[model samples]
Target chain A: MSDTQTTVEPVRMGRKATQPLLIVNDLVKTFGNGVKAVDGVSFTISPGETVGLVGESGCGKSTTAKLLLRTLDPDSGEVKFGGQDLLGMRGRALRRLRSRFQIVPQNPQTSLNPRLPVRSSIEFNLRAHGVPKPERVERIAEVLEQVGLPGAYGDRFPHELSGGQLQRAAIARAISTRPELVICDEAVSALDKSIQAQILNLLAEFQKELGMAYLFISHDLSVVEHISDQVLVMYLGRIVEDGTGSQLWNRPGHPYTEALLSAAPGAERERIVLVGDPPSPANPPSGCTFHTRCPIAIEACSTKRPLLKPTAGGSHAACIRTTDLQQP
Target chain B: MTVEAQAELVIDAAGETSDAVLSVRDLTTTFTAGGQRIEALRGIDLDLYPGRVSVLLGESGSGKSVTARSILRLYGASAIIGGSAVFEGRDLVGLNEKEMQPIRGSGIALVPQDPTGSLDPVRRVGAQIVEVLRLHGVVDSKKEAQARAEELLGLVGLPDPVRAARSFPHEMSGGMKQRVAIAIAICCNPTLLIADEPTTALDVTVQAQILDLFVELTSSIGSAMLMITHDVGVAKDLADHVSVMYAGRIVEQGATSTVLDDPVHPYTKALLAAVPTPDVPRGNLIPIIGQPPVSGMTLPGCSFAPRCPVAQSSCTELVPELVSVELGHSVACPVATEFGAA
Candidate 1:
């Protein structure tokens, strides 16, 4: 299914917008120290659909992003992008596929080059994809305008801009190539609330116009639920729950999801304060990793590992007592 | 005795000295850098009662950190402080370093913003706690200090206190490092605790646990807390009283439910509207246009006038003063005050 074209279009072409843009099956990554960071993770994203990956620190959300981005070589997995095998591609074939996928990292200050102008940074991506120099300048201008940044901002260095402006520049650079999928790995986590809202709105607006699917990864559940069409809860290197935003928000099936919702500030429901820290990834529990801190955990939870089973809430949860724990 | 007697006269002159553990009046902080004077904290008034949590809520560059640092006298020589921080019948602003040494940890403890930055990377976690105990004379013998350190570690909810005590800062997680920081801060059990976004670095679940720990430890010791955060939800969950700051000034201050539920100031209302809650549907999130004014920028009138939605012509002419709408509730917006009066 791999298509290598010498002339790359600025927009996604030929694929039906409703079809799956990216698909992953049984992705697994174990580090040097025997820590299974991303263990048997599998999900799919359609064109223009946002899938939020929410989890605590060291819960493999970031590692999953890295694996999908092909920055880290996974131990075992299959990643298909635009009906092409992303894992098997190498050399120029992989490089050509890269223009169809992009990333906006967490810190724009570090992601953006300090020495170069903002326009040049965006131009670098287009140039790498073999775009002509004249076309690169025009595309940079178009993206900067789309992101609501002033045209003069293109000539300014990153240090001259504020955090919000730098993030805008980062977004401009990411969309300059008109990638079908953009992985925002905690993109808005560093900014203040108001700035965060502005960036979120911008991303949503661009997705509407460009029809780009987003893999929005963040530890902030509220932000995730706000922007995501589907949300996945990860814990101890495994996906514990997967459902629609409203489904996960209203009737969280997994104990870990319930605890996360309860722990969020201003949650109307009674707070369920989980005890102790998450176990080390390298030394994760045998049966169920989250059973140690699950509020309604039983003897079976410690003895038998639970698979992703459909719960009463219409969401898939990896828990033995999801039905019993769901509130009316 | 003379300082106490002088403090009595000052307190009476300040009027209506309630049972506040820390009473701040007209607290202003200025920094001089590159021959430029920048006002970090404009004139402010606050009253923190024992066993209650008062949160200073604002966006970045709104002077929340400056307020906490000014109280602790943590700034360098460039900072020109003008205010009164009265704690335990003594003014802290005028006290010299030698005089402030005993009061810093034993009288009022500080939980800094970053636990990783505050903790000693090279030393064991237990040694750091024990050093604080010894420095403040909390315990006499080294062995006793070590035991107390372990006890404090357990109090902060470290699962294996002995193992955690022996572990280095690098050996622990972000949550564990923060717990160690909290353990050291409460080692002396001061009357006032200043925590600057203590849970901002941790995960949401871990943040919930740490916030609960703060409440439990402070109330048990009857210590008033001044928490600084940019999150309105955090203030809502933890604060008994909340102060909404904008452009180096307190635009509103009231009980948490009162201010957050029925915010009068346009800036406070805008900030709340900007937050992305779980209930708020996608595409409904309101983005406050324009950036917060850079710190130290000289604005003639209301600093937030340019961004405030309800700002009128007069808002740019005169700086709004805090008007008491009701008991323990105040707002600095003229339009909001007028509406309340009507």
Candidate 2:
């Protein structure tokens, strides 16, 4: 990046907490094999807050992450980041906007370039975003320090680092770009328990320091509840429930969310063993996609496409019996 | 039998002398890699009783899987096995391939972590189970083996056993594949069944179902289970006896409720505290301060001393051994042991 190039800033920074950092509405995507991976998913994320998107495998959380990053284009709907129409942006504009949000991938082994030293991966992001050469050097050292890695570790290759260290390096690379939002798709799920806590703490620390929002995605419900302020449960390509972590933990409105809570190992609640395998996303069940496995699902649930509605517990759920289900 | 072994068996008060289906004593395994011997298991001891689930709980490098594999003699030429693993009054440690053949499936069976890796991808799920049944001589004919295969699938809670038996490994979901794996493992009615993180790859709801199946099948068949997992919740859910491993040694072992609720070893306490559970509030997880020692690295003292909160000056010099804290509960921490004694 050269001085005096005078490139336009893609995103205006420093928004109030009331305004959303990322707004996704009715996003839809279907794969080549006709799998409706993401089906009309909609959510909003405020700056400096963490929103957990959780579900079992094949529930479209990864597809949603890809669509939000524009790595995979959604077949329909809008993704507005920092008041700009992200999906409508052209080549240079889209590339310029890329630095505004970044990803901390699940597995750092594949995400980080194995051949290059850790410094180069972080430096690559800076250079691509047009950070000056001198600034790039400083940012690399700074981010590495912020993530609790020693300055000397920048010289080491990916394989030299442990799983936890690689994840920290992944976080350093993501934050080196100074992105307003970081999407952590199963970031800590791959790590061991003791190491997982360290990474989670680092994320919380960085979020407070940088004031960046996070779209934390994981199959582990407890980890999601621990890190996220707001929680969204997805089943068969749809958001079954959305609420604050406390609301969903105490009084889950959707049967899928309730079943998920019960199924968690060591969860003291009565086990609701959902029989049969999850149906293929390509051939999802009609109306309520979870009706096939929901323990409390009524016959009407299969016929009616229940919209996201507010429950008595102040959380929004997409179940007809959301109000009456949580009576004890 | 050795005179010392006979004396120890009679004096052992933790469990009934005749109850154990498998008794592992001072089991150690070492592998020669790059001309360096990696001591994966270091003087481990365990007693697996019939109709009970004993969980070996630890992280990846803690040698939980190695313990299970060593019992079954899964390692080839690279591994140097030490100590004894007695199953049904027979020592399994020194047995050759031919001698161990009959014991492998009929005496003991394993349900590995990944069903996809364990199951034959090309063969139908039923054919695989039938092969195990016929190979073990559990059933007389192919016709009887086929019927037993479908019956075993249904026992593991596969809703449609007939259809599941016809499908290939790729055709079934992770949960269903795991069920098939469980079905094959329990088909022989082995006295000892080892499940290595059986539900780790499946969804939570599916994990619950599989856990339920483990309890039901183990009790009904009157087989002892040695379940290996890193998840504390999984151990809490299924384990009747819990053994916590750290840096290739058993740090704690006791009844599940006693060990999990009143953890004596600092490592066990820290591990249980660190895990994010439904009851623990957000951001309250107290992470263990340091990394676990590199696997196979010889330690002079307790492996956990570097990270132990209540480490004493002597802890750096003294290697802790499992000392009884209560009936059926033992902790390998000198500091904790002293406290319990006091």
Candidate 3:
């Protein structure tokens, strides 16, 4: 199928026509031991748009997600949500804005309380936001049905439910409060192929129906390509490449992005195997963090860091040889 | 590199009929949990041909891992195992623990899924491999075992084998630990190797490299491989033969190309369609409705009937045997049998 044919037109929610819903600039987060988990990242998520964050392990994808949610404080950054300063919000302000942002974690089995029934789990969040008991009950059933789970499933414990069912319940809870933007961190990675498809379809359906945005973080490229409007490729805690899904998939300018795309199965492309492992984030290489593993690395790559610049394919790539690289 | 070369390799090692180094027939395993008998494996039959890769593909709780554990006799004492696993004219199922001692490692090696859990955290990587080599009598002296351990590490594509051997399990990455596990598995050069989801914990790039390493190592050692995984892409990339298992039974088995390209079984077809390929558009995923039958639950006929889209009344009434519709291709669904023949 063609990329354009598969693309789902974003349904505009009840927001200002032109203003972006969320805007982040120069976000930086460093750990206790001097590990730059998220370093100098910036992106914008418009209403109802799915922005995919792709990277391997230790590339700060999860850290970036946490930073965006304010679960981890950023060293320096400006986060504006709905024309309001999100990073500057505190106390009652942050709690009130909590309902507008929700996160769906990777493993639903661990995320849900084993002792609590699915109903109570969904109700807990709504009750925390001061929703009435009757409204919470009505919303619980509606959200459960929306996630393709039966109403009776609310009475069942997490251990009694299947992996797929438990994940559906978790999604139900995330959307129970009607969050405008949901952060899915490796949400469908733990599921089987069949169940993964079901979950992906559910996510897309909810996005269209509710007119919500998603910051989908996953290492799986195919899933990202299917769901994302814009894609960001991170390497060693830095955004190395950024473009629309079709633009990035069809023409990857960065060497790291090229290798990652080639490694994914079912793509009819030549495999470009890198020579060595990724360098540790704690001791990343000087010039280009990816210079140690880049297939087309030169002497300059080890000395001078390349900044993200506009490439030929209407994408931004942090590679000095972006112009010299062949189109994928 | 070519089809001709693969064909030549297949013929050079063993002729078609005598290619099976290990043949499992009517293999059944039962476990008692909370005083309830669970039929984990229900009369499974499989063949592992020498120098060829055979994949057992299934979803979780589909008995793919149980089949691997049963072949190695890794179940507890309460578990009852019934069947014959014949390897080189010997029935492994009939052999006791004392009798199966030598066959465990030297005859058949295992590459487990979780590398961190499988390796010794306290011991250096090289010492663990050396222990396996010396225990299997693959080498004579300690010095020789150490040399062989580093050599095996190098063979598995570890860039600095010496450094990797000196490092502990905690010091290495997931992919690095897996490479070390592969080195330990092939240290003895057994006739058969069982890798259970060896690359599931790794990244795509690492997984591809490990898959290549498996093919290379197995081919060089002329060892038959029985790999278990839930990913169809891994099977398509690695398997010479593919067997689709569901609810503890082999629903379909055939040559990898034939089965993947033209699947006859409904379950296999659904599985292939469910994977989110790069070419497939969003919202077009054909997800299989409902989940697999829970463990210990007895179904009258086809276990997949409740979820099968085209299941007939007869499918719920009678269990179908694995009948062949074409040469080397078998299916356990009556409706698929009729449709495939047509």
Candidate 4:
């Protein structure tokens, strides 16, 4: 927040034709003298893509989101958006970038101001981007219609609506300014499955309509699978695996990824059960972060850090034993 | 006289069946808020057979817990429960707190959600177990209570029972704390155990372990169980019988597989479709478009028609009661015969 310091990146802007709509490479962030909150994480999302970022608590998925948004300061690496270095933006430059990106944060009940009515909440986003008040009502109405709520519901307070309805109002607020990239942070985790389905469907529909991208963050794999075009699996402040939703869920490469999929309630995993809790991120293992809990862990996996490598297709996993990880 | 005897013989049609442990007939509870009456239950008819797991599945605010608390007489004297909830041929609905005290924790018990929260934070878990035993008059001696507590811990698959018995709730994991709650629920060897969202707070692997323990313990003791949960998957996997509740009433009831696999009521079908099943691949999911009616919400006909896709004009005008469709299946919907179940 200081005026003098700025978010500067070391890497040069890559090619323009296929620049990642959002690029987060080797993003390292730490808390007050704490361990790496986001350790060596990398992912890229193009236009109209929905990338699901999933993991259990303390997996640094939330940390990665903050880094991408530039709300939190990263110790190293770069966050690039639109073939432009996002890490160098300062003050007005950063504020302008924020207009292109918005976040519908977790827990709509607490996210939306209780004192403010739904109408005012929608108007705030438009006003922030200097949209005239005369046109606010029209833009708000369009977003509300997209989420399947009538315009009349706009004047009511968030408390007046049900949990499902309140979330729809939150979604309307996020996209009212038509941001190119939106961050849905556990947007539907608090909602019932039926309500979750509606929100996920609405997100997909909006992506096709607006050609926007999303950084979908959640611990629930079901929601991740339903909405995300590609998926990123994080554990202990690191991205364990990254690939298409099918390859990640149906055929995971990392030991941690397999454990996560198997841990799903009704997944019917092939009798593979993760025994111990994941190691603490603050005091992570020396080499492979997941070796402590890996079931088929090799001796090499414990002492030597493994670089993320391609496995079979447009998928990559960070593990030493490729043969063991590829086992059926 | 001979004709009267023959009629009585046919009236007792269900012969060779075991006597019901807890029978509820026409049970209903209403509340008066702001000078308006809110009917929480409308003539709930149910039976808890010995050693059977009867699941009451419903979404939030569906009166599932009200049914459980009503039998325990926990609604206070002002609740005005109608009809009878017969426990061992005794009308539990009419019993006062003093009269019901001896039965609770002795012949009936409850395993609530958040096992750690269920126990007193300041007291040691071992002492809490002993307190339950003393309350039920199962063991007057402290040594006897402690011994029984250790045994119960072992029964629920806890490791190092002696150490766990002395440990506090904070020292244990979520699964271990739930096991401690189970240990307390079965300490008195009650005839029935009521578990209300016992596994909701735990992870998947831990949930499975706790559920399996419920089956193992209830069967071993021949104690009937009443499990109230929002998850339909667990109901399918665990319950022998399932009762689907919506808008403070049982809309459907039958064998678990039959009810879940071929649900009749539109509400039941919608509720089942809501859960994201892993067996079913990722695709477009069918979600009920609208919210369930809040308490005291009423329409001209069916409660679920507001969100039901197949709702007809007639469905909005006339309320329907449970209609028998087969030997065990029953549904409360006018369009039950027409709706093609999933």
After superposition on all C-alphas, the RMSD of every candidate to the true structure, in Å, is 4.8, 5.4, 4.1, 5.9
Q: Count the backbone clashes (under 3 Å) in each candidate.
A: 0, 0, 0, 1
* Reference-based lDDT, each prediction: 0.87, 0.88, 0.86, 0.78
Residue B195, model 3: lDDT of 97
TM-score versus the correct structure, for each prediction: 0.95, 0.95, 0.94, 0.87
Quality of model 4 by C-alpha lDDT: 0.78
Worst 10 residues of 1 chain B by lDDT: B1-10
TM-score of chain A of each: 0.94, 0.94, 0.94, 0.92
**lDDT value for model 2:** 0.88
Model 4 spans > 4 angstroms off: A1-17, A32-37, A84-90, A268-271, A276-294, A298-301, A305-307, A312-314, A320-328, B1-18, B277-283, B338-342
Q: Give residue B150's error in model 4 in angstroms.
A: 3.6
Give the lDDT of residue B143 in candidate 4.
93
* Residue B133 shift from truth in candidate 4, angstroms: 2.4
Candidate 2, residues A224-272: lDDT per residue as tens digits?
Answer: 9998888999998989888878888888888888889989999888877
Name the weakest run of 10 consecutive residues (lDDT summed) in model 3 chain A: A1-10
Q: lDDT score, residue A192, model 1?
A: 93
For candidate 1, what is the total of clashing residue pairs?
Answer: 0
Report the Cα lDDT for residue B242, model 2: 93
